[model samples]
Target: MKSKERAIVSLLCATTICVSWRGFRSCSPPQDQRPCACERCLSKDDPCFMKRFNKSVEPFLSANYNLSEDDFNWWKRLQHEKGNFRTFRATVARLFLVIPLSPDVLEPSPDRCRTCAVVGNSVNLRRSHYGPLIDFHDIIIRMNAGVIKGFEADVGTRTTHRVMYPESSVDLDNTTHLVLAPFKILDLEWLTKALTTGFKGRSYAPVMVLNPAFIRYVHHTWLENKGTYPSTGFLALILALHMCDEVSVFGYGADSDGNWSHYWEKIRNKKFKTGGHPGNTEYKLIQELDQQQKLKFYTGF
Candidate 1:
């Protein structure tokens, strides 16, 4: 080959080598191992806060009722320590951890906010025996799209804490209820609009809980603990189970008929559902808790 031709061929080979290396780096997937920054989990409550929380949570369970050491340890280990979780997919150099939150958050509300109830609109409430039982809770936390009117009167009306996404169907007024929304980037503009000009010092208090933290926490927990993050309904139920003393869960799950429908849907609509909040496995767990008498279900299912 001529000297000029040899130089050109060598140049082409070098270019090909660089291009292939770039492609290889780009195609490589991320690794699962990650630091416990909990940047997405929210509570970096520090060891002191954790120490205080532990002290209060442990003894409270033993004094209030019977909790075997194993059960208590299981609850503690599962909820507090990320060690109990399993890892999910790694994308963009991120590792998601999923841990099953302990049922221990049930021990008489560490802060004891008088009364709190977490409510969901399961078709079970169509039977309607929970109104009075619900009223007993001083603070009631109801979630997105849950019907306040047209269902049982007392079971829902006295709501103190109403949790809704920015796109939630429920309206917010000064006298209506406190709004707790988990934050979202997609919802950022609406959230900004709500705070700056829309909800501006509106009558109702607006509380924001970032969704990424919960999602990251739940995702991590799900990855580590097993199964989907226990449905939003079950999580809400679990939140209530943890926060309240005399708790009542009204309007959740389907009757034996497998007719999983809500009472407040458009008339004659059989296709109604709880949106994307949770699935059937969670619905069953709710029933299990009810049967154990850990919580009172007003659904009559």
Candidate 2:
């Protein structure tokens, strides 16, 4: 780990400080005696619940946004040394000028339950037939290139948000939100260029960039500083916890045969791993969340 990262981990370990959840004003009210949708509002019986949701971190970047020096340095060190703060700021400025930016905040409601389904690209979804169940949610969030063309019965056709990087991006209709999980400065540059040049013909769709501070928050708090950074799928899962009253996870982890592959594609590499992300740790966290009834988890066969 880098010196800065080590310091961050040490600080978290030393203080055990939990940041407040910032964007949402209210959390969902419980039905009967059930737990609320927002984990922060859960009963204090589980001490660790307090540390899970950090409201201080903004989820999406808006127009005329500026990152503090500390956040800038921490974000730049996430993947590669793409450029300096000046270059990053300039790129963001130019990008915001061309593409329309929106504050995509989903506030909790007392009368309504905003359910969300976070669908990953795991091959386990192949024959799950979770389409109707997934589409039943108020919001459906898909990640990367987890295609839904012919696999609609298994992956669902409705997608409120699609979380992706430049490489894993797919063309979408205007109804879906293109949530970019930027790993490096180059990914931001790519988004700017892609939107400006009409890359993948996605100029009409709504766009939102994930806040780097939120990324850091997830790294330090949610994953406990595990792996290099949290995977895009895991980030989307956390985002769902903040945006919806009820959350359901689908298409994550290896299949019944312990094979890792995309649902739309055949398994070419039997020895596939989650690359730089801590796959096991993340899956374990997901299971724990399920156990706590924070979110409903479906493990497809």
Candidate 3:
């Protein structure tokens, strides 16, 4: 064979070895053998895994910090609401005085895989018997009037985090964390007044307000700005994805009878539909995530 031809063949072999070595290094597992739900798709080059997950978005608001004009304006437009910026700043200042300014953010760890169960208020949870399964998770996140007294067999009794807004707020114990999803500035004022003076009842739970920027991220990136805004349950599910290494969703879609009422409430409206939110699109996205094995989704019977 000619010397030039030999040189070209050697170069091709060297290039193949280099590419193979790089792929091996990238796919190598960590030293810790413990299983992680995110490791599979993340390491296997799943196209949709990291497409919508924005790590730079902060999940909670802190004290002594001011939101940018763009963030404030975008957040206030959720409900077509209006409020004075000065008043909103003052309310946050007062709120920080009473409770903690900055709560500890949950970061992903190599040694431990944090599991979270995001429980919704869908009517499908009526007889699921998922109470034990839900309680087994490291973090049990319940949202929006998730009652546990009578339906403890289905919805579970333990709650590590409770997501709520001013209108859908419920009394919480000291152990559970109150995650407030404020859409308008008045919601912030309501949280301050509720904690300082008391709203419907007293609550000693630690408070964490969802960041407006994070909400915008979910709407534009995840939902592609499909609806007016994402619902509270959807927001809580996304928040769990950020906070936990593994996530299991429960009681999300409609029941077998196609009713859209809450688990605790009777079927008053058969044709009840979500207001201003793209409920169907969000559910389809969730189904896709489940299909891709990104998160475990439980469609309760």
The prediction achieving the highest lDDT against the true structure is: 3
Candidates in order have lDDT scores of: 0.47, 0.82, 0.84
Question: What are the per-residue Cα lDDT tens digits for candidate 3 across 1-301?
Answer: 6999999999999999999989887666554643453455223355576788876778888985568778878987887666766766777787788778886556665666788999999988889999999999999999988899999999888999999998988888888899999998888878878887875575766789998888998999999999899999999999988888788999898777666679889888788888788988989989998898778999988
Give candidate 1 misplaced runs (Cα > 4 Å): 1-114, 152-154, 175-183, 199-202, 216-231, 266-278, 291-293
RMSD of each: 23.5, 13.9, 4.5
Q: Mind giving the per-residue lDDT tens digits that candidate 1 earns over 240-297?
A: 5434544567667765556566566633545554454445656665565567555666
Which runs in model 2 stand beyond 4 Å of their true positions?
1-46
Which regions of candidate 3 deviate over 4 angstroms? 1-25, 32-45, 199-201
TM-score order, best first, reads: 3, 2, 1
Q: Clash totals for all models, in order?
A: 15, 3, 0
Q: Note the residue pairs that clash in candidate 3.
A: none
TM-score of each: 0.53, 0.83, 0.86
Mind sharing the TM-score for model 3?
Answer: 0.86
Over the full model, what C-alpha lDDT does candidate 2 score relative to the true structure? 0.82
RMSD of 1: 23.5
Question: Which digits, one per residue and each the tens of the lDDT, describe model 2 over residues 88-148?
Answer: 8887888788667666656664445678999999988888999999999988999888889
